[model samples]
Target: MKLSSIIFIWGMLLCSSLNLFAQQTDFKNFETRESTLDERWELTSESSQGTFVVVPYKPIYILPGRWSNRPNKLPTSLNPDNVAKIPNDYNNFEARFQLSIKTKITSGLLFGKGDIWLGFTQTANWQVFNEKLSRPFRELNYEPEVIFNYPLPSDASIFGLKPKMVGLALNHQSNGKSLPYSRSWNRVVFHAAFEYRDLSFTIRPWIRFSEKFDTDDNPQIGNYIGVGDATFVYTHKEQVFSLLVRSNMRLNNRFKGYADFTWSYPIKGNLKAILQVTHGYGETLIDYNYKQTTVGLGVSLIEWL
Candidate 1:
């Protein structure tokens, strides 16, 4: 069965398990509520009698190529002044999960909204430049994110403002034992999102800032200043289309750009799936041109509490 179908079954099982636990409770003061836990999300409603969660699995393909810079055809060390070099066949694979969690608060807060997740990401880059090694570069990361949403009254839009939300994320990466120069990196990112919604349309814009630090530099490649990244997400729900453009600026004067297009469709109930293609380009370690492209199919586990 497909990943989505499997997740639905797992969620049902979890709900049933929670119900059994509730019935076995001896204290009358304690109440049993439904809870959900999956690869995508684990959620529980405050007044709910049980839990409901969903897990989504994604199989993705990534193609990172330097069409203008070939590893074998060019000099061992690239010379930026020379423009006649061929491109390289650098490709990679990525498995990604987008997850979330939501629970109603019993006290203090009036509004209810949960967290967002970038989920689990594993990327492997096949280096055409060095074919003799066991591998080129492999990385795995699990980064769960949290988002807080605060809705503003309609009159707030008159001042060119809309509902605002904030998000925070922590990402930790582990470079497998392949390249001798393997090093780990940790990053903390903060985001602020704003949304404008009317009866017929919705527009959302968000900005993110991040800082990365090196953990163990076994090879002793000194660390540099932090980096900054920002993105703009535009969506037209009526047309089932979304556009995402992201740019990262480094203190060392290097920058990366990402452009993506997505088409989405409803799969079952509140769940939706999206197919996307992302094109990226940036500066390599030697300042040579670096390019990457990826095509992926993703499932969005959606809910409104």
Candidate 2:
């Protein structure tokens, strides 16, 4: 069997089990207490306000100086037409920014405990310092997804960790360019959120939908970007710290992955001073197969709770 097929089956089975566990569990003894994940998704009646209200989905930040050790100048792909003939005149130091938002679409489904949400995230890299070639945007990625979230019982525990929620999402990501610069992919992502006092963990395993061989932009994207990722967030007083790890799950000397660490300290009001360090592939859709290390310092308006 193909690795992709195996991964798809496993994800489906795991989601099914989660659904069964949710259905069979007794919620009569479960309290209405809220956790960070609960508040983030508005699980309880106290947090939710029906639908159509916009909320932050991911961290929103602008890094004026995001320096990369190595930038991908010549992007190559399996498809001949998608390969860049001339190396791009990209600056090692560029400005990076991300904007993400989500809105609740509807609620009350599947035993009266499910909500759907629509989310959009946009990330961009601007070559503001490269004046010789005329300053231009290096890359832009757009991600839009639809998620169905099922909140677990407040008292639910799985393997010593408090299981907060389980969800499934249809995700589409693209660079929105033409020909050699274009890149896009679709995925079915499974989500599980857990907490353990002051720290929260989210695991997302995804299955990439196949594309026609001739038209596929990044055929080996899964090998570089990985099939899943895990995020851990820790809050200490007015400071928040996070780590994200991604792996292709390959063995025998063909391993590929990515990891990033971020620190956000409150500056004033809702503003935060943010520092981020990342190493590995897939920092952006255009850099999916390109590996590099980067450091970014910026201000953030919101962060993962």
Candidate 3:
């Protein structure tokens, strides 16, 4: 059987289960507990507040010694004009940092069940140790997105997992560069969040908007960066662990994917030590098709819940 067919069937089954269990679940005697997701998303009445309050969207960290097994010295694209003319003097080790934040734009949509949010994430790779390269910034990616979130019933469950929310987002990601180095894409994304005890899961599937072939940079990016991703976060005391997996979902020889695992432990108040290890493609927009393994140790200001 084809992998796409299997995925379709699985999705249908999941939807049916959600509907069935959601109706059967009892909420009368259920007492809501303190939930990390609720706090992060402001899902409940107690959690929701005025607009314009900033919050963490993704982990914010700086890795001073990020080592990559392979570096993409000369980035290439299907568009001949977009290919690099000469190889860059990139070091195997670089400094990496990410800053992500989100804020609620408005609330009380869909009869007071949905909220709109604006988010931005920026990540950069810096050649701090490459003195010969004049400590240049190798790559920078900017992602801005608008999201609509709808909270589920407090006690709603799909199978054994508690359903938290469902939403949609308009997302745009780009490496702000010109010529052979420019890479950008726009996506319409679907989001679902669930929880099982201290573990939280978020699944996002996206479809890219079409672009003109002549102007499209990284035309085959979908095959490398993937169509969807799943993030699993688990919390234990002061420690947090997360795994993010992305896949194109093709079962044949063209299959491609990415995986990132992160561990964060508290170092001080609101500050944590983080270690991240990633393997596969799309670590950066410039290296979207370049597969490599990288390990980074850093300090984190915020983490996924």
Query: Which residue pairs collide, candidate 3?
Result: 82-180
List candidate 1 segments past 4 Å from native: 1-139, 145-155, 158-160, 167-183, 198-226, 230-239, 250-254, 267-273, 281-290, 297-305
Worst 10 residues of 3 by lDDT: 24-33
Q: What lDDT is obtained when candidate 3 is compared to the true structure?
A: 0.83
Clashes, model 2: 0
Identify the runs in model 3 with alpha carbons over 4 angstroms from their true place. 1-34
- Note the Cα lDDT for every prediction shown: 0.36, 0.84, 0.83
C-alpha TM-scores of all predictions: 0.44, 0.88, 0.88
Candidate 2, superposed: residue stretches over 4 Å from native: 1-34, 158-160
Model 3, 20-68: lDDT tens per residue? 5335432211223358788778899887656887766777777777999
lDDT of model 2 at residue 278? 97
Candidate 3 residue 224 C-alpha distance from true site, Å: 0.7
